[model samples]
Target: MTVNDVKMILDACILCGEQYIGKEVHTACGADMMSDVLAFVKDQSVLLTGLCNPQVIRTAEMMDIVCIVFVRGKKPDEAMVALAEESGIVLLSTDHRMFTACGMLYEKGLHGGASD
Candidate 1:
């Protein structure tokens, strides 16, 4: 699904990377574990997490993720937002919990990465 589609699906607010709203994301992974994200995610363009930190942006950078959805009303701090802006990653905030956000995206045809 496109980034705009994700925003619509999750009723999310754009935190940054407004220019990337039209980008397409084929896969999504929802997790708070950065290691799991780095190790298991492949070509996954979107990350859904409740963790709000600069490290989350770093993990997204490592995985080449283009979009990040902060679930459960979590908001990234200024540093995290600046980092994401610098890295050209789209940041979205949604009131839905991680599980609900993931399910919504999945129902809209966005799938998770392949399992090991």
Candidate 2:
């Protein structure tokens, strides 16, 4: 799916990276643990997470994720947004819980960061 598709799936806002909305996403990962994000995610353009902190952006940067979706209405601070913006990572927020958000996107064709 594309970043536009991800925005639609999560009903997200373009908190940053407005220029990257057309980018395509082949995979995704959902987690609050930065360690898990670093260890498990691979080639995922979008990150669904509730950890609205600087480390979240750092993890996305390290993993090369193009976008991050903050779930359950968790709003990230300006510092986190600045970090994401600097890293060229799009940021978004949604009210949906983690499970529901991941399920919706998965049902719509978003896959985990793994291949057969």
Which ranges in model 2 have alpha carbons more than 4 Å from their true place?
A: none
Clashing pairs in 2: none
Candidate 2 weakest lDDT stretch, 10 residues: 107-116
Write the residue-wise lDDT of candidate 1 on 1-116 in tens digits.
Answer: 79999999999999999999999898999999999898777674799999998889999998889899999989998989999999999999999999999999988888886651
The TM-score, computed over Cα atoms with residue i paired to residue i, of candidate 2 is 0.93
Off by over 4 Å in 1: none
- Backbone clash numbers for all candidates listed: 0, 0
lDDT of 2 by residue, 1-116 (tens): 88888889888777888888888888888898888888778764688998877888888888889889999888888888888888888888888999999999999988885562
What lDDT is reached at residue 6 by model 1? 97
lDDT of 1: 0.91
